[model samples]
Target: MLRFDDLQLFVRTAETGSLSAAARLLEISPAVASAALKRLEVQLDVRLFARSTRSLRLTAQGELFLEYARLALQNLEDGRQLLAGSKAGISGLLQLSAPSDFGRNTLLPWLDEFQQAHPQLHLRLLLGDRVSDLFREPVDIALRYGAPEDSSLVALPVAASNRRVLCAAPEYLARHGQPQSLSDLARHNCLLYMLGGRVHERWRFFDGKRELSQSVSGDRLSDDADVVRRWAVAGVGLVYKSWLDVAGDVRAGRLKVLLPEWRGEPTPLNLICAHRAQLSTPVNLLREFVQARCAELLAHAPWNA
Candidate 1:
C-alpha cells in the first residue's frame, strides 16, 4: 500500500521545485527526501523528476502524477480537520429514533430549535412506535418511554417524572358520561395504540397505594399513537398517552383529563443506546436539550396545573 507520508512529500517537492527545500520544509534530511522520492518512483515504475544541479523539474510522467498526489494529500488533510473538529465538539450528524406521537408532537419542535442553535449539526430522525434495534439499526440514539426492556442497552433518564394521562374530549364525555373509576373504563370506548406490533390495550395506573393494570378495547385501533390521540380529539373514544403528547389539547379544552385523582404509573423518558460509547458530543447535547425542554413543558402542562 502507498503511504500518506510519501504522497505528502511528493506534493511538497513538486510545489517547492527543490528536493532539499521540500525536505527542509518537512523537517527531514535532504538524503531522506531523495530516498523517499526514489522509492515512490520505483513503486510506480515511473521517473518523477528530470534532475539538474541548478534545480529539479517535473518530467512528463511526474507532472501527471503530481496532480493526483496533491489531490490525495488534500483529501487526507480534510479528513484530519474533520476529526479535529469532532474532538472539539464542533460538528456531526446524529441519527435518532423516537416514538411517533412524541417525536412528532413533542420532539420535532425541540429538534428544530436544537438544530437552529447549532448550524453545523445535522439530524436523522426515525419516528415510529416500534422499538428500534440500536445494534442493528444505524441510529446512534433513541428516545424511549419507560425503562428499556432490553437489559443490555444503556438507558439514560431524560425525563425522570414524565407520566401518561388518560383523557377524553368533552363532547365524548357528554354523550357517554364521565368515567369516575377504573371500572368505569370498561363501559367507555377506549382507543388503543400499537407499539412494536402489539396492541396497547392494557393500561396501567397508580392509585396512591399500588399499581393497577386494566385491559381495554375500542371500536378502532391504530399503529400510530398520534392517530390515536387525534381520534380522542375528534371525540371518537378515550386516549391514554404521555401528558407531554396531549398537553396542548388539554390546555385548549379539546380534551379533559379523566380520573384526575389517579395518575398513570410514571413512564420516565429515557435516551437509549446500545453502548455508552455512542453518547458522543452531538448525542449528549441533544439529550440535555430534550431533557431541559421536557422539564419546562411538563411543569407548565395543563394536567400538572
Candidate 2:
C-alpha cells in the first residue's frame, strides 16, 4: 500500500525532474525526498528513476505510474477540500429568489436566523411575484408554490400538503357576510393577483367528489402578491393565497378562512433549482429549515379542525 506523503513526493519529484527541486518546492529537505523515493521504489520493486551525475530521469515504469499518481493526488485533494468545507461550517454566497409575500413575511426572518447560525455565509435575496428564470436569471435557487412545469428542473418540496386558502378579514366578512357555499363567492368581492402579465382569476376548491371552480372578479388586482395580501388584511376583498403566505395572518385573526369545507387547490411549496447539482450544503440546510417551519404552521392551521 502507498502512503499518502510518499505518493505526493513521487509526483512532485517526477514533475520537477530533480529530488532537490521537488524537496524545496514541498518545503522538505533533499535527503528526506531521496529517502521517500527509495522507499516507494522498494515497495513497488521497480526502479522508478534513472540517476546520472548530470541529470535525473524517469524510467519506463515511472512514466506509466505518473499519470495514476497525479489522478490519485487530485482525488485526494478534492476529498480534503470537501471535508474542510464541512468542518469550517457553511460559508459562501447563497443567492435565492422568493415570492413577494412569503419572502417579506416568512423567509426574511428565517434567513436572519440561518445567517446567524453560519456567520460566514453571505446571502443575496430577490423578492417578487414573477417567476424568475433560473437559467436566465442570476439566482441560484427559487422558492415557489406548486411543482415546476419543467421536467428538467429539480423541485425540492418544502410543503407537499400545503394548499391555497380562500380568506378575508373580519371586517370584510362582517360587511359582505361570509360565503356559506361556492355559489356565494359570485356575490362577494375577490382580490386578484397577476403573474406573467395575466390575472389569476380562477379559484378552485375540491371537496370529496365535488370540485367547485369559479372565475372570480374583484374591485382590485395587483402585480405584487404581497399587496394583494395586504388588501385582504385591510378588509378590501377576499384573497385566495397559499396557506404558508397567510398562516401568520390567520393565526393573528387578521384573516379568516372562508368555505372551510370547500378545500382550495393544492399549491405545494417547493425549492426550485436548475438541477440536482445546485443543492449545496447551505441550500440543503435552508430547505430543511424552511420545511420545518412549514410543518409547524400546518400543525396550527384551524382548517385542520
Candidate 3:
C-alpha cells in the first residue's frame, strides 16, 4: 500500500528538483523529506533517485512512478475541490509572489481587504523584483508584469498599465534643458534600471507615424525601482518609470513627465499559476478576488487622465 503523504513528497521533490527545496515548500525539514523518500522507495523496492553532491537525477523506474504519483495527487485534489464546492467555504494557505514596489503600494492594500472578506483563508505574500520560478518556488500564484515566456504556467490577464513615462524633476530639467529630439538625450544624464544583465538605457519614443530610439547614458543604476524613483525625485537625473509608481509624485508636481506624447508600449499584468488539472477552492476564490481588485484599481487611476 502506498501512503498519499509519501506520494505527495515524491511528487514535490521531483517537481522542485531537490529534497531540501521540496521540504521548504512543504514546510518540513530536509531530513524528514529524505526519510519520506526512503520509505517510499522501500515500499516499492526500487531506487527512485540517483543523487550526487551537486544535483539529483531520477532513475528510469522513478520517472515511470512519478507519472502515476502526479495523477493520483491531482485526482485527490479534484476530489477535495468537489467536496469544497458543496460546502462553499475557502480555507487554505495561499502563497503569492509579486514585484516589491507594486506589491507594497498596490497589491498589499487589496490583499488586506481580501483577508478581511475571507477570514478563514491564510495568505503569504512574497515580494521581490526578480522573477521566481513557479515550479521550483512554493508560491501558489504570482502577479507578473510584462508578458511571461514560460508556457508551462497558466497566465490570466488581470490588468494592464500604459506606456511608462520618462521623466525627471523640474530642477534637473532646468540644469539640462529639455531634449529637442531623441538624439539630444545622449547629452543628458539618465537613471537606468538594470534587468536581465543589461541596463535599459535606450528610450523608445513615437512621433505619430514614426518611432525612434534614444541611446542615453547613466552613471547610476539600480535593480530596485523605488530607489530609481527617489533618485529621479531628488533631481538627480531622468528616469523612465511606470505610472503606478510615480503617478502620485507627478500629480503633486514633484516629478514631471518628459516627452509625454511619445510614450512606449504598454505592459500587461497577469496572474500566473501552475497548470494543475484542478484548482483548490482557496486558489479559485483568491484568483477571482484579485482579478476584480486589479480591474477596479486600474480603471479609476487618475495619472493617465
Candidate 4:
C-alpha cells in the first residue's frame, strides 16, 4: 500500500525538481523519502521520475499521476481542515506575485485590509514586471494584468472591465500642444514601459469595430511602470497605462485623458494559479475581495463620467 506521505513527497519532488529539496521541505531524511518513492513505484508498477546527476523530470506516467495526486491531496486536506475546524479560519503563508506598479499603488492597502481581517494568515509578496512561473516559483498565486495566455494556468477573472488609457499631463499639452488625432500622437513624446528587455511602444486602441496599433516613441523608458507614470505626470511625455493605475492622477488633475472618443485596448486582470486545487477558502475569499474592490474603484472613476 502507498502511504500518504509518499504522495506528498512525489508532488513536492516534482514541483521542486529535486528529491533532497522535497525531503528537506517535508522535514524527512532523503533516504527515507527515496524508500517511500520506491515503495510507491513498486505498488504502482511504474517509474515516476527520470533522474539525472543535476536534474529530475517526471515521466509520462508521473505527469498523468501528478494531476490526480494533487487533486486527491487537496481534497483530503480540505476534508481534514473542515473536520478540524480549520476551514472556519484562514491561516497559512500565502506566497503571491504581482506587477510592481499595481502592487504598490493599488494592492498594498487592499492587502493591509485583508491582513487585518485574517491576522493569523501570513503573506509573502513578490513584485515584478515579469510573469511568475507558478510551477517553478514558490508562489501560490499571482495577480496578472492580462488574461492567462498559457492554457495550463487556471485564471479566475478579477477585473474583466479593466482597460488601458492614454493620458498626458496638462503641462505637457501646454508645452507640446494636444494631439489632434491618432496620427498626431507620433509627433508627441511618448513615455514607455519596459518589460522583458522590450519597450512596449506599440500602443493599441479600438475605434468602434476597428482595432489599431500605433508604434509610439519616447525620449525615455523605464522597466519600472511607476517611473513611467511619474514621467507622464511631470509633463515629460504621454503614457499609456491601466486606468486603475492612473485613476487617482486623472482625478487630481495631474493627468488629463486624451483621445476620449477612442478607447484604449482592454487589459483584464486575473488571479492565476497553477491548479484549481489551490483555490482554498482563503484564496477564493481574496479573489472575491479583489474583484469587488476593482469594481468599486472603476465605478467611481472620474474618467467614467
Candidate 5:
C-alpha cells in the first residue's frame, strides 16, 4: 500500500529537516509534499514527522525508516548500473552452430583468435551439417549457407560472394584424367555428400550463357561434408565444395581446381538468429570476425588467382 514517491519524499524531507525545503529541492509544491508525508505516515500507521509552523523534524520512527528507505534507493540505482554495464560488456556464453567442414577446417582457429581478443567471452560451439533450430534450441547464433528460408529469422551476411568449387587432388588427377568439359564429369569419380537425408549428386555450373547440370557419382559418399572434402584431399575423388573450404588445400597443393571456365553453385554464408533482438554485442562481433576471416581466406582462393 506504500508508494515509492511518498517514501522518497519522506527521506528527502528527513534529510533537509523542512517539508517545504525538501519540496523545493524535489521540484514539487508544498501541498503535494504535505500530502505525500501524510500518506506515508498513514500507510506505516506511525507519525513520521513532528511539525511546527516554523520548522519540521522527523520522529524516532521516521529516523528508523529513513535508513531502510535510503538503502532501497541505493540498491535500485546499483541494479540499474549493473544492468547497463552488462549490456555494454561482451562477457557471456555465446553458443554457435556452423557447418561441419567449415567448422573443423576453418572456424576453429578463427574463433580461438576471436576468444583471445575477448578474454571474458565464453564459447559453446556445435558444429555439424544438421541445422540448429534457433527458436527451439539453446543456440544463440547459427552460421548457415544460402539465404534463410524463414523470413522471421535475422540473417547477417558473412560471405555473400562465396560459392562452391570443383576440385580434386593431384594424386587423384594423375590417375583419373581431369574433366575437360562439364559433360566429362560423368566419366570421373566425383565424391558425393548427403544433405537433408538426400545425396547432392547433381552439380550445377554456369558459363557465360547457361547453366551446366551434371549428375555425378563416385565410389565414396558421406553425410558429413568434411568427410567429402577429406576424400578429395586424399586422392579418392573430385569434390565440389565451398571455395572457402578448399582454399587452404588448394594453396597447400593438396587440391586443384578442376574446371576454371565454369562457376560453381552459390553458397553464401550468413549468421542467423531467431530474431533481431538476439543480435547482441558478442553475436555482432562474432559475425564481423567471421566475415573478415572469410574475406581474408577467400582472397587467396585458387580461382580468384
Candidate 6:
C-alpha cells in the first residue's frame, strides 16, 4: 500500500541529501516533499530518518527500505521503456558535458546532425576541460578523454585517438632545423601541456623496435590545446598536440609533422553515464549517434598515414 509518488520523493531526497534539493529536482515545494515523507512514514509505521536541526540521516530501517525502493523504481522504469520500445522517438531535455576543444571541433557538428534527425529532443551541452561530477550535476551524459577512474559509473569506449605529435610551422623548422633524434629535442624549444600537477614535457617516441622518452623544456606552456596549436602555427615553439586537432593544419601545410615514423599509443575516448538500470530513450539515441560518429572518425584519422 505504498504510494509511487511518496516512494519517488523519498528516493529523490536520499539521492540529493536533503528534502529541499529533492523538491528542486522534482519541481515541487519543499513543504509538499516534507508532507509526503511524513505521510509515507506514518503509513509504514516506521521512523525512516533521524532528523537534526542541521541534517537528516537515514535510519537503519530507512537504509534497508531505500535499497528496495531504488531497485523497484528502476524496474518500473525499465518496464515502461520496454513497453515503449523502438516506437518511442527520443523526446526530452538532455544535459551533456565534454572537454572544450573536442566538444567544439568534434561533437558540435555531429550534434547538429543529430538534432536534425530528432526534432523532438532538446539538448544542452556544457563544454570545459574539467571533469563534471555526475552525482551533483544534472547531467545525463558526459564525454571523457583518456581513462575514467570512477568504477561506479558506466563507461562506453566510443573512439580512439593518439596522444600528441610534436610539430612546428615550416618557417620555424626551417630556421631551427628539425630534431633528428630524441636527444636533439633538447636543442629545440618545446611547448608543454600541463596535466594534473605535472607538466607533460617528456616526449615519447617509437624508433622501429624500441621506445624512447626524452625530457625537454620550453619558454611557453599552456593547459589549453587550441592555444598551443596557435602558438605552434605562429612559429613560437614546437608543440605536442592531439592528431585530431592538428591533422587539418598539417594537411594544409600550415604545420609540419616532425616525427612521422615515431608514434605513441592510441588514447581512448569514452561516453559515460550514471550506473542505472533504466536509461531514457533520448539518452540512448544520443549515445548511439555519438558512437557511430566516433567510429567514423577513428577509421579516417589523418595520422594513419
Write down the TM-score of every candidate. 0.70, 0.72, 0.80, 0.83, 0.71, 0.74
Which wins on TM-score, candidate 5 or candidate 6?
6
- Candidate 2 local lDDT, 1-305, one digit each (tens): 99888887887777667788879867999888889999999999999999999898889999888768766765665454477667347776677999999999988999999889888888989999878777545467999987777888889899898888999999998899988888888888999988667989888899878887898888998999999999999999999999889999998999999878878888888999865656777788899999998899988765587
In model 4, the clashing pairs are: none
CA lDDT of each candidate? 0.83, 0.84, 0.76, 0.86, 0.82, 0.76
Candidate 6 weakest ten by summed lDDT: 84-93
| Candidate achieving higher TM-score, 3 or 5 | 3
Tens digits of per-residue lDDT for model 4 on 139-230?
77999988776898999899887888889999999999998888888998999888666889889888778998899897998998988998
Tens-digit lDDT string for candidate 1 (15-101): 667887779867999898988988999999999989888868888999888657755654564465457665344465577999988
Which portions of model 6 miss their true places by more than 4 Å? 1-26, 33-88, 161-163, 169-177, 224-227, 230-235, 248-255, 276-281
Model 4 global lDDT (CA atoms, 0 to 1): 0.86
**Model 6 lDDT, full chain set:** 0.76
Predicted model with the maximum TM-score: 4
Give per-residue CA lDDT, model 3, range 178-274, as digits (tens). Answer: 8766677788889988655578877777756888888888878998777788889999998887666666677688888776667664656777876
139, model 5: CA deviation in Å?
0.4
lDDT of 5 at 276: 62
Q: Specify the highest-lDDT model's number.
A: 4
Our model 1 lands, by Cα RMSD against the true structure, at 15.1
Off by over 4 Å in 4: 20-43, 84-88, 170-174, 194-199, 207-209, 222-227, 233-235, 252-254
Model 2: lDDT of residue 223: 95
Per-residue lDDT for 150-263 in model 5, tens only? 888888899998989999999988997888998888899889998777999999998768988899998998989999999899999889999988888988899999888788
Q: What global local distance difference test value does model 1 have? A: 0.83
- In model 2, the Cα lDDT at residue 112 comes to 95
What TM-score number comes out for model 2?
Answer: 0.72
Better of 1 and 3 by lDDT: 1
Candidate 5, after superposition: displacement of residue 210 in Å?
1.4
- Candidate 1 stretches greater than 4 Å from native: 1-89, 301-305
